[model samples]
Target: MMRIRHDQRSNEIPTPAVSFQPESVQMAVMKEKLTDQEAVVAIGQQDVRVRFVDGVPSDRSFMVRLVKQEGGTWVAQAVPLSSIGRFVPASLDDGIDLWLSARGIRLTEKEKEAVRRFWETEGGSIKQKQETVAALTAKQLEVTETHLRLAHEALHGPPLGDLLAPLLTKTEEPEETDEAKGVPVREQTERWEGSRAYAAASELVLPPAETRTFVMTAVTEKMRQLVHDFRVWQRDMARQLEQFSHAVAQQATERATPLVESLIHSLDRMLLNGDWLLFTDMKTETKLLEAGAKLAEAKRGLAEGKMDEAAKTVREVKALLESLRFQPSEQKVMRFFLESDERQGMKPHEQLSRILKQASQAARDNALSARGVVESLRRLGFFHEQEAARALLSGERLPPAENVKAMLLSWVEEGTAPAQAERVLMNLTGQQLLNKFTADSHTQTMLYQWPLSLHGEMATVHVHVNARSGNGQLDWQNCRLYFLLDTNQGKVGISLQAIERQLSVTVETESEKLAAVLQSYASTVKDHLEQIGYRVQRLVFQPMDTEDEERAATDRIKTENETSQWEWTI
Candidate 1:
């Protein structure tokens, strides 16, 4: 519908014959070192459907002339839109010259006058517009140029057109002449009826009514039946094409459904068996779970004949899978984590789950009172501290220690955990961790603090419990753990704080050596915690500010040992 005219003749006048070789002009330019003022005109002229306002499509032709500026970058200005129709559309090289000369672009007086004479000879008006009719801004021109380049690339190859020249050249169809229209049936019949042989045959023919009745009842009915059959066949083919389009749209989902289902089932099994934390904050697992849910939605949409929705959902799933941050080595580790049975007996949360169940029942005997519930939360809090420290000591494989360590440290420092695990598994720390942290009553608060040891390292855990509510169910609202780890070089101050029920870790020490050790081992600790369903925040390392470093270390260790008491104080 958007037509580009070569001349200002409206639709009535026939176009003039004009030709320009773009290749010839380009070759000539390549042979010479062109000056800045003597610009080789590059035109991005086209009639396109552009959205000018409110995303409404408008048909407009643009003639942009790009000139090389001081630094070799091209800057463009819009030529009068009417200039596009002044020259032949296929004559791109001539059109560029015409546009430049019309605007008096970088031309000598003699050259400009010669171009003006040629324009006049071609019936072009010398009365140019004071300004470009619909000029685009520089940014808009850049976008237009990019679109033009892409369009050129799509239409023509990067090669010198030699490879596709035959295809590119216009192959004009044969024009239908009036003689080729063929003789009409009425004319042919009239000639036959006027012939002497036709007159002799007419004399032996039946009356007009009898002849008409025979043809209508027999030949005409037969022809009508054939036409109806052909129409039915055409309708059947159209229905098949519609069905085919739906099939194509749904094909990807159909192919991926089995694989996706298998992976989901595998993940479910892994979580159920307590293979909890492969990495701190099972984000990869969570994404896969979400993808599975979306895949289900897509299936439903497809089954209900919502092809567009199904296609869109499938694309989203593809993108998510592609965007997974796993490296090749990490991918292998993930596969091992999913498929290997190495952690069968070492289910990360097995011990924690058993201990919580016992604590829960013991607390329930007292009608789920705040004191009893706080005790359970206290035990759970201390467990994570011990586990994190233990993992640090073991130097466990965490999907690349530094990244995981960094993630955990950020979580710790920012106190921001990723999206909460949906339906935190009741069997593991899910129900226990979320349920046990709360406020002790409205006014009077209940707090639980305890110390834990990991291979001679000392740590303290603090749990703030909410008292019995009107429903009689108690919850722990906040918890924190402070711990220290001794490395070969010095002492590292490691603290894990779980505020608002989210766990985070921090490290502090006077010695840079000890900080490095903690920094290296932090990811291992995070990995272990994550495996155990502990979403740990990032790590924070701060230097001990004391002047007497040895004394400071002694004081820190003594303070931790002094506070290593299993006491429940209100």
Candidate 2:
């Protein structure tokens, strides 16, 4: 007889007690039955104990594995039939390939083999796999969110096309004539005027007179608010200046007296007819800020008992106040602000390249810390560099692509310029979508949409880089780079491909004048490439229409694939 113990806590059967039988009887039974005889077993959800007797069949039975315990007794424990199969480790490499493919990224056979070996070398634990999946999902979600936000903005905000329509070249419309309209010229003109009036009237339920009155009221209220704010700011500044002048030396106070009198004069004029409000241009604001800074400097100098220094700063402040009094016309200021010409005569890429070169030299010379590097790059207007530095400082070992996106998100949280941040966010979304559609695992591709200030205008340059790697390392010699931007001249597309240090370049533009200009600089471009250890094999200018741009890109990619051993699809 054998006794079975049930676990009180779990209501699960414990290991069956060892059954002792005579050796001769066991041998005889084993000889008669080549395999172990299965015994009927029934287990309820709450019950755990199993009873064994001489041959009573049941629906379910436990497959027991017998092992000899201490002395001569044998122990029986239930073994699962499912666990008897040959063990095969989970294939994380396969999972990764499937995931990439699902996101529209195709891997070459060689790339697949490399990835498989990489996975084998760097074992993928369950935790690692989970983290990888989570990270990718989060990136996808972020891209989706960016796209949704952009869509919302496009739907709700003023149409960008409408804003740009005036700048774009317009086709001449055929002049309308009375003859064409089958009416007399005077009557035709009257009918057109009446139709315009009718259309205008149809737009609003209120009459034209009422609409005009409403607009006038709104304008008056807005002007009143602006005047009030200006008066408050002027009063506060004047009070502060008075206090500062009192705390300074006699010479400083004498110089500050003119500034205080000027502010009081402006306030008095504003009180009379609000004529002083008309002079509130950006230049005036700048001068006022400079005077405030000078006042602070004078105060600091007075605190330190430097009478001469305080007087000098006060004199500078007086000069700034004089300049503010002779401020330029509002029209001139508006024209200056509207000017969008490229003063430096350099493309966005050229400007970026120059800035990067300078930043690199500066970083090396200064031996800048990560945060210092970030600030320096930001000051130099290199957005990518700033984000990269921030990523390194974040202490997360993220890939370059992910690092950029992560830092962009952090910048949003840190309250960076909304326009700049949103531009980057949209750029990232575009890049991800592009990658998804045109992915090549053999050649790593990165897309960057860099916003550059070409003089006064903000120009976005789309940079696409494709680098081929055979041994899981970047091959700079086997790479392609494309830069695309819309300039005042036209849409410009520049493609540079390097195959074993032999470079081929193509500059395409819609404008013939721009094409000619680029062609003239072909030799200079070739020389520059050759100086950088690349033998310039080809340099050509091609005229491409805006409509054919996408087709040209596709054809170029196809041609590249045919010529190169490694596929270059970005």
Candidate 3:
């Protein structure tokens, strides 16, 4: 293998100065963070040019200008010889081979043998250890950056000055109360539900499914804390603004005024979304709107330096925020559950079936038994264990199933729950909820017999549908169909007596050729049927025919021969 060597450096490759310049200097400055014309020129100049000899570079060179490190050290990066202009390869493949050989990546015969042995022994563990090291390095870098940012903040002050400037400039104008900033409420809810559903259907279904509930509960509590914290913080800010210097007071006022207005504005927007209305009543929404108007008035007063009026308005806003509560909507939650992309082009029944299948697989993966499944549903407050069991056995809907689904979706939005209705659903297996709540259930087997005309002959095909195992392990052998050839293909005597004799006894044949023909036919038929959902379960072949009389005589002769042989030997 050929190796590239630079005379100025040790065994380690020197670090190269990295710069991005996709096009002209002006374009680079605008898009690639090239600060000035000098920077662009520095990056574009090919100060170091490399030439390849045999398979390796004779001298370490680059297409761009190389910037040296503090001690006049430079970084080296592998560049394709094709881009260097001086080195031309025979062909693309030859160039690739040369590149690999130059990098010592292409092994020698002895090295290849050694590698093969290593792979046969410890390749997997070595590869795994390398990945672990890489992951740790990346994590370390991330933590280091976070610590650096924190240190910078502690040394200086918070970066609030930059963030508050734009808002503070518009302090004179009344802030716009209600406009959608992020995703639409409906879309956000859909995305949240879709993510939850996707997680439940993934390889680790039970954990994600259970985790969704836990996360939602945590979010609700967190949001509650946020609202409380913000209100208290605003109250303190309002009090300080009246007593502090104008600069400090002005900044505090700017921050507090917008925060209150934003809180009220977001509340109004959420109320506008019908999903939010499921948890909040019309009376509550109307009250919230009134609070928002008061908050706006307070903001105006604060801006105008009317401290008393602003204080009075802040108190009103705080009271309204306290009065506001969240509750989950049943219909909206159900809709979220039912939502799916039409591009999959599945029927409603099919989609429901798929969801149930995923749930069952999730349960099995989580090591949940039938009784455990029932208990999970009861724990989720979907229904009592007895009720869930009965509902599953009878394929009936549980009474509290809607509420259970609604509670499951409480995490979709902060204000999507009623305190009483949104209870923590612990250890609720997704499969159990699907099995206990849904009316349609998974069937173990389905047999369908149909007559088909094949090769100018009529035959009956029996299709057996074997439901997959709870964990989604498909027993392909058990899920098949059997084709029974009609006995009327070859004609017997046309007389009534002959026909009666033919029909009286079962026709059995000892033919290897027939079995081969039937096997081919079964495969062809199975493939075609499966395209339209009728999958073959198993093929049951008939027993081979034999001559019992001949076999019995042969057995007696063999026994006599064996006895004579034994006597002679003795």
Candidate 4:
């Protein structure tokens, strides 16, 4: 029920006149430019609904004025809420301006004003609220302007009276003489109704030569009646449909039937006649298994001679379970009671179903699951030690080489083969590497963490890193600088870069040959990371062993890594 006013006198003001031609205003500037969308141009009285990109998945709702900038691009500047106006009710942007105006708000200047208002909120915690609001408001304004322009065009004739100007100008309403002014408005509307577009379109079908005043009058009356009847009938049918739908919904609820029941019923037919292979759903499977387990439990109790109790429980459970829509299982457990003697019958449990006979088959299932584990272990190669342990203790299978190597290393450390149960605990190692590393970009520069796991002289890095902090003394041990290799080379340290679980290198070798050797080793390491699908964004060099330099590296590692040369923003 929005009514936009252009001037003081308002007579249920209709659509706004829209024009792209400049009329003291750059009409083109009134147009909106959608960054990734096509512009929608409209004119007068039409409502514009423009969705501003909030960059958030869910956007808050509001209405604002659509204004085009000098560049013919729309910008959302929240207008004073008091200066807002209403749009037509049915329109998308209809009532938007009015709503804003009613609230004494202006959409065109929304970003600037909204930020000011929101900052008053207690503990808001939004640092760049103004910037975010500006971005969103700008996007909304563009869309709003486009819609407003389109609406304007629909009502007013191109505002410049351009294109089709003659027809609009030529058409004029009949003059009301003094005596005719006394007639009711409806009577006047009816008298001239034939002059409307529908009457003209109908007249074109008649034979000009056969046309007469009487015949024309008769035809016009019939046409009016027909249009009236159609409208009335349409209204009645609409009312009936709405009532019937509501009643049907109410009846369904009273009968305690679920909408899913209908869907489930349709599924059987759909499966037989349409696609069935694609019907798998985890939720449906879980429901089916649940129902089956309940049924099995009921049957087990019945077998134990609790007939009455089992019957009541099973009946309620079955009906409740069946009420839910479910995907049928490939196989279902069915228990058949056996008649032991003429005097009595044994229950399902006494007869023993497959699930109940599980103890007799536990060994088989366990073996199958074990085989699956081995296949995966074989593919990974790191589980070989476990496999060998299993074989030695239980005569299962051979272990992989990597697994055996880890086990051997563990045994050397402990100086003895740990107990079966303790072996699993002793081998546990955190992320291991021994080199310079970087932290996540979101972290502060004061502190950073690196993840690493090392055994002997080998460092398995899983991330990219950078090093800085020129020269200073460093306590390598406290800093987790383990797995160091000192061969004629000064010192080679490895560590995991915290951002990505990848290896980093810091070589302190004063020997040129050793440096070259370390670089060669790094090339191999890089290749390994690439093979494992890790992002090798950067590889850097910096001085370690110096206390000040080392401490500096530790403190600013995160920022240094993020700004490193080898790092790509993407």
Number of the predicted model whose lDDT against the real structure is largest? 2
Ranking by TM-score: 2, 1, 3, 4
Q: Rate the local accuracy (lDDT) of all candidates.
A: 0.36, 0.43, 0.34, 0.32
lDDT of 4 by residue, 1-570 (tens): 999768666557665555432211111112443433333333234433232233111212233344443464333333333333322233323333333334344454543333334434312223233222322332233323322222222221121112211212222323545653443322212322322312332322223433434444553454445345434533443343333234334543322222222323333223222221112233333343333334344444444645444445445444544444322111110000111121123332222221112211222212212222233223222344445676899975553233322443555577664233122222121111111122322211111121111221211111222323212322111122222333334644444342322334344433455555556666666655444324445554433445423433322222233232222121
Candidate 1 weakest ten by summed lDDT? 130-139
Q: For model 3, how does the per-residue alpha-carbon lDDT over 414-519 read when each residue is reduced to its tens digit? A: 5644332222222122112212211232323222222232342323322223333332332222232222233343211100001101111111123434544444
Compute the lDDT for candidate 3: 0.34
- TM-score of every candidate: 0.19, 0.31, 0.18, 0.18
Q: What is the C-alpha RMSD of each candidate to the true structure, in Å?
A: 40.2, 24.3, 32.9, 41.5
Candidate 3 local lDDT, residue 137: 26
Clashing pairs in 2: none
**Residues 34-136, model 2: lDDT tens digits:** 1233332322121222222223222243333333343432334433434322222134453454344334445456645544554454334433432323323
Clashes of each: 26, 0, 17, 72
Q: Give the distance in Å from residue 508's predicted Cα in candidate 3 to where it truly belongs.
A: 90
lDDT of 3 at 351: 35
Cα error, candidate 2, residue 197 (Å)? 71
Q: lDDT tens digits, residues 1-570, model 1?
A: 999768655656554533223211111111121342233332222111111112211223334433323353334334445544543533433554555544435445554344434344322123221111111110122223322222222112122112112211132223544643442322212221111212222222233565534433442343344344434533443343344345546565464444434443443443332222222124544565555555555655756767677667656665665554321122222222222222234332332333333333332222232233333444334234434566778995433211112333344466652332111111122112222323433322222322222232223232333233422332222433333334445555444544433565545566666666557776776665554344665555556544323322221221222121221111
